[model samples]
Target: MLQNNSELKSKIDQLWNKFWSGGISNPLTAIEQITYLLFMKRLDELDQKRKADAEWTGENYTSKFEGQWIPPEYRNQSEPEKFAIDKRTLRWSEFKRMQAEEMLQHVQGKVFPFLKDLNGAESNFTHHMKNAVFIIPKAALLVEAVKTIDDIFAVMEKDSQEKGQAFQDIQGDVYEFLLSEIATAGKNGQFRTPRHIIKLMADLVQPQLGHRIADPACGTGGFLLGAYQYIITELAKKAGAKDLAPDEDGFIRTSVAASLTEKAQAILQQSLYGYDIDATMVRLGLMNLMMHGIDEPNIDYQDTLSKSYSEESAYDVVLANPPFTGSIDKGDINEALQLSTTKTELLFVENIYRLLKKGGTACVIVPQGVLFSSGKAFKDLRQILVERCDLKAIITLPSGVFKPYAGVSTAILLFTKVWGAKDKITKPATENVWFYEMVADGYSLDDKRNKQQGYGDLQDIINQYHARDAATDTDRTAKYFMVPRSEIADEKNNFDLSLSRYKTDVFEEVHYDAPDVILDRLIQAEVGNLDEAELAKLQSGIVRDLLDLKGMLG
Candidate 1:
């Protein structure tokens, strides 16, 4: 379906309303309380399906699938029919009376053995849920909320693959919920990276449908999801007939929207890859991928900052918006990605640069000031890039790009591997660089950022980037300028990635009164009031008297 901004926003709001209607408002809290519900629902649904399948073959299926011992509890009150339902209310009071710790220990011992590898589950959630604090102000409200979500999931589960408008609607809602959680994460630089930024970077690189993409700093996996979207849309176009409308985008079966579970599953391992240090964020990122229809996500909770990968792991493309502040703890930074600089952003920049192959491309976000800061640390890094890599573009975004959000004046730097551009028989290989001042990335990002308004208008940018010629002296100060490899290679190699360093702003004029106008105003204000006239006369007399004396000239 065609979607305008208004349409997308409306759909997102629709999903939020659906969530409230289904009652899972506290996403942070719901997972802990809803685990028991999910377990019961799965138990009932799985056992019944197994029994049906087995009876068709005249075999005993109940004992084989549900477990060695069906929990005595399952026999009392059956699975809640929906993801929105609370598992606590039962016709089974005795089961509810089982102590929280004791029940989980017993369940973990006997029940979990059968339900291995459920989607969106982490082993930790199961291990901790029994003893996890379920401290919502009102336990009953929590119960009601869980029941509502139960109903919602039940409807969703009618078809295993998520697809169509409802799938889009539901997943869009989930995206915002995930963003909200990150927003509240606050100051830790766990703040949300605007999706448009990801989309814009995607446009800049236009990753081929089959290429691999990774975000080593994958916060909430925003970059990974963007890469997934790019691939999915492109893949659909490839599979579709030349003149016909698009084919089933992952096979739709519902009035609601969802990801094609199998399509997403296949893509998860092959296409999208990410890692983050924050365990909380890793969970949310996985859920974000799953809720958006990705099954068996590739996201992991390990700190990418502390790990290294082989040359085989080099990606065809890498996109990252590394956190702006904080230094990597001394002994913890991953050797592959770590830089000589203790500052985390600088370390990540060098890390991302190193991770790409001889010709791999990267689009990374950085603080505007990093481009020209004459520090000893960044200077050499800049030198390495200019001397070795093909440094292509710099985009300076406005200070308010983060507005009402967080104000971090930033820029995007583009680079590609040099391959044998170095050690070639020809002249120095990496030469011209393009610089563009996004002024705005086509969006307000203002609690209201718009794509059309800022650099979000990417078609022109992409075109200019391709048509861009070799570095030149004159174009260096133009709005969208070019700098020669020689200019960049100069002794300083300022590699200051800031766009403003190269692109000249169109300095606008302001009206100014002429000098006569200023003099007339001064005379009108100070001229012959009796006191002013007398003072002027006294001053004139003193000058005349002084001038008449030889001593005055001497």
Candidate 2:
């Protein structure tokens, strides 16, 4: 979402070069230095406005936190505009009046709290302020470091094209880097969702205004962000307004601005909830929400599985690409969400069920193997979902969805918690699983693609999904087919959610050589007719395959 943020980039790079050259000994020191620069910029922008307005003490608290504090000798300045990185010795001499911890305590309790009290603002800066270290007294390079960063953000503009942050776009690399830096124990396989796929999935789920959305695993909050964009996009389109880019704020029409402002206000007050096991993810989630201009996100740092969530059918929409963790420690899940079983996806499925309100909808990304992974666990899950919720659709995504890095053959599994299902629609439960197979799903399993070529061409599959009624098992041209509920029941309640089971093979037209042409070939050079026994065997095989198709259609 960055645009014209070149200042941020150049300044950040400059700061990095300076810090690396100085040979800062600790990783914490690097993060602290960068954070300190961000803190100061934020502080100056906020306080200057208050001071100009004479809002503090009725007498203007004119710029106490700005670059004015650094001594000129320690400052990095030009002839006109001046700023400085306070020298190490000078910083110690001036700041030695307090201990390192006390400096941090003062910043948190006094300086940071002043910014926290601004009107029309609600921030937990005080909370995260605990992690905002002021180790200048010990890591004295830290004070000298703030100037290099001031130079960085001062010059480089942030790139808007990069998906998550202005820094990286290698798909999930944002979450990957964050996990390495902040939360290495980011629960097995809990990486971020791919961006394009997130957008596609959100479009299909179609969460609307006033609907509550939740992602229990909530890795770096990709789904929540996607859903937010989706809803906002639809709302904007409905209001006949442009989907203004973040960088295009100056182009906002009065009508669009008013609508977006109202919608933004509504969301902060009413919708959006998320939880994660990792505190670091929770912080990232909050930052993400804040960057997207959502205030007061109800994102808590808690283990949804470990906590008892009793409010069954509470949310309107649920979207998750949960960690494909295979099994869990017996003690991990709370008694409510804890099944007698251990498979992570299965537990999450049940957890989603409990979280949804009646008639609520949910879309989940799951390992394709789950569809047919034979087990008492899978069978029970299939039975519960088909019976309790209207199992609507299953999209078999290509195996390379997470490729080159993590190649997992995944599928989009969807369900709706409704008043009830038509218990006996004269079909088996196993047959009821509408399996849609995209040709893209069978593409090269190598976990990488040419970025120019794009990945997973599933628009046709999505077309068929939206064409719920027009779709059928008879039209072999389409990528999807459905079995009757009775048929699904026949799989002995094994709702594998695999597409291959439901989609009939599309037989391309084969042109056979004419009899005269064959005779001409024989006359010109060639071969004899097949013997009776061989031809009979071929005929038998054809007959058997026809019967298989016939049965698959039913």
Candidate 3:
């Protein structure tokens, strides 16, 4: 959507350049600072909206900004001597109108502390807000950033209204676009998944409202948000709302609040969760979910593959594109994961399996080498998927899916945990595994990833997945088909899951001219000075001979 608004992008780019020029060069930190400002603005707007609604409806409503405040200098003084400042002055709407220097000082002195204390000590925002620092360094930079953000939000409001999208939906898009900027800024191993691919995975998983969903390596919480949006859209449709409408890039924008009952919304909010190793990413993920209307997203800073994480068999649906190019220390790896290596990819895959409850399902992305690598850890992980769970689908993605950061080929592994009575791991329920080779994902595979029309396979993959039949999908030459588990278990295959391993290429036979005919044509053309017509005929004969040879080779 940002691609459709060049002016909006130019404003954002100017904002980023201002940050770099203002001394905050770290992309992650820049994003965090921007997030704080956006949060401040949204908080004031939310309070204002609630207050107006309460006045109109004659309902008792408490505003977050309606409270007394203590000045910093008087806080340590005796109660009688201490002076108080109105909390209303700390509101973003009020402080943003102050002079540049005064505004910077007030935000650092009062507003940030207020943000830290928001909700309560137990809220996710409060927990992550503990270490938040405003380091813009210059009031001019802050003022410029604030103005740019105001413009950004204004454009977002107009765009959302014109497109019949919720403000929160546009907010999510804005956050995603910012995240993509971070990815392009060269944050190592932190590329956010393309929105279209996230939607495709969400559709394949078809997460329900009550289902518990999680992402272990949730960079910016894209997959978790995708699942949340899908669930919301389905709920809306069930409530007689129109089917989700796609935007220019094929993303469906829907209002979750319009469809679900209060109780259902509360449950939906708690049903989504995420975990990440990076503290900065955890903060971003939480903010990303919060901006999209999730009041209390369960995102935390925890290495799911490390011993510090202990929530086994907890989630119902696990969706992730875990980091593939790193490995953890052997001693720090969780004891619950039985993999023999410290490879983060393998451990994260196994960790996802462990995190699933009985009958739980997961759709995860892994490097392509995981499909056919002869490494013991690789083969062992595949064995577990094939023998212990219902291996549903192996969708191979193009190598450039994570372009500019990583061109490593990857695939989505969809499987369900099978536990017998007493939660014992049982034999797999898999009979056949569906394989889909995605050559394009609606965007060019290049680093730019510009949108392209009629080149993506995501929707077709989703549609064919629901209608797939092992009996009818027997054409190995096609992009979508099923391969029986027996064939996958063949000794020569070594449990290879790559589509190329099972797919049969159709080669056509051809015939060619004899070598003598080609040699004679060449000699005739090069021999004595012949008439122009004779030479022309000989040239034509030589071309025919070459064509015949090429056809035979084909």
Candidate 4:
């Protein structure tokens, strides 16, 4: 989405390069340091705005930067202790003006510790920040990074004013851009899902306010954030907002904070729950949500596949693109997941199902192999979806969708938890399953993934999916159609859910001439006796023409 502003993108690129040259070359490290700086700036600005707003509304306000501060470590010392520093000095605006060396020392020693304790001891973000290091080594590099961040924010403000895009939206985009710098996949095939794909899933699932939404393997909380944004945009729409615009992916969106009421904000903050095994990812996910105005994000460092995770049937919605590879130790896998295999991909599907309350919906991404693998475990997994739940849709994604990190073909599984035989003894829960084969996702499938002009099949998938009717959407030749449960559960198919199993391929008939006649025409062309139109036809169908010619020659 930041691609719309070349200047902002260039500035962020320069900021990243500055970090690379400044001895913090690791992307995760660089992003963490950048986040700290952005947090500093945002903290100061938000506090200032709130103070002013309180004044205008004649309400009491307590600024986080108010009052004198003493280092907690030195607070119990005897009299004459000189450890007190101005609380205001921690502000980005104040320290940015200091000489580079002094600025670095103040930030490293005081500001960072203050930030670590900003939310008090009980905060998850503060707990994660306990071990965080501010490693901008050189004074000149730190100064340049801070200056560049200021310029980036300046550009964002200008763009907001000129384009009517909310400043909060631009801020979220900036953080997303920074997160995108982490290019490599983590252990267990963990990689950031494309944001547009997340948006598409959020649209199909339609996560509403007050819904307990979750992502079990949330790397940087993209799905949770997407749901949050989707909810906010819907609220903005209901609030009579007319400035809403379609994003680069064609989904209408606005700022996360725009028109957000305080009561609604608190509920939204508590609605999102995420878990990840990687400590760094957990921290990043927490900050990712916090930076988007989700105070008290529920992301934590816990492997949901492990036995320790037991929050089954708890959430109203689950949106996830879990790790596509890696298997958990059989002994360590959560007993709640009853999938017959140790395959993480298969088990995660079961885990997501368990995570949902009865009748709750989930939109998950899984490897295409899960759809039609010959293994009995795979068949059982599909059967669980088809028999135990209402398997609504299977949207196959292009292989290149995860380019530069992975090339594995994937698909989105949209389903709802249901009581199959227990409630309906005569038949299964799912009556029909919809299928859509996505050809493109609005970007080039190469490493760069530059945005294309149109959102190929993305918009259509959303519209056609919501509007699909079992009786009307039966044309298998179209891009999207529905298949009856009996057909999907046929013995020969073995519960295969792959789109190719049911989709009808239309073939065109081609008329061919007799071999002798085709050879005579080619021979005439060889002798330079044929007209331009005859030569063009022969060239256009060279394979067929040459096959006929070779047979006649033989």
- Compose the digit string of candidate 4's lDDT tens values, residues 1-554: 58789999999999999988888888888888898889888888888887998899897999889876776687788942588777889888899999989999999998988888787778888888777887778899989998999999999999989987778878888998888788556446776788889889999999999999999999888899999989999998898888677866788976547378889988998899999887888877877777677868898888999989878889999999988777889999887676768898998898898888999999999999999999988998899899889999999999889886778899999999896323563558899999999999988898888889999989999999999999999899999999999998988887999999999999999999977787777666664665788767766676466666677668
Compared with the true structure, all predictions reach lDDT values of 0.56, 0.56, 0.82, 0.86
Cα error of candidate 2 at position 522, Å: 27
Give the TM-scores of the predictions, in the order they appear. 0.65, 0.64, 0.88, 0.90
- Ten-residue segment with the worst summed lDDT in candidate 4? 419-428
What does candidate 2's lDDT look like per residue over 70-113, in tens digits? 33233455542343332221221233345556654544443433
RMSD of each: 10.9, 12.8, 5.1, 4.5
Q: What would the per-residue lDDT of candidate 3 be over residues 1-554, giving only the tens digit for each residue?
A: 77777877887898889999999888878898998898888888877886897799797988877767664446677792346656899888798899999999988888888777676767887798778788878999988888888898888888877877778777877877777777343343456788878888888889998999999989778998899988888877778887467766565657456456779988988898898877888888887887777878899888888888899888899999888767888999888888899888888888888989979999998889999999999999898888778899999999888886678789999999885223455445678999999888887888887878763887788888999999999999999899999888889887889899988898989987777676556565564577878777866876566556656755
Number of clashes recorded per candidate = 40, 34, 0, 0
Ranking by TM-score: 4, 3, 1, 2
Error of 2 at 461 (Å): 3.9
lDDT of 1 by residue, 309-414 (tens): 4433377799998877768776876656424677876777777776677778889988766787777667766765666677888777776677656777788888
Q: Candidate 3 at 182: error in angstroms? A: 1.8
What is the TM-score (0 to 1) of candidate 2?
A: 0.64
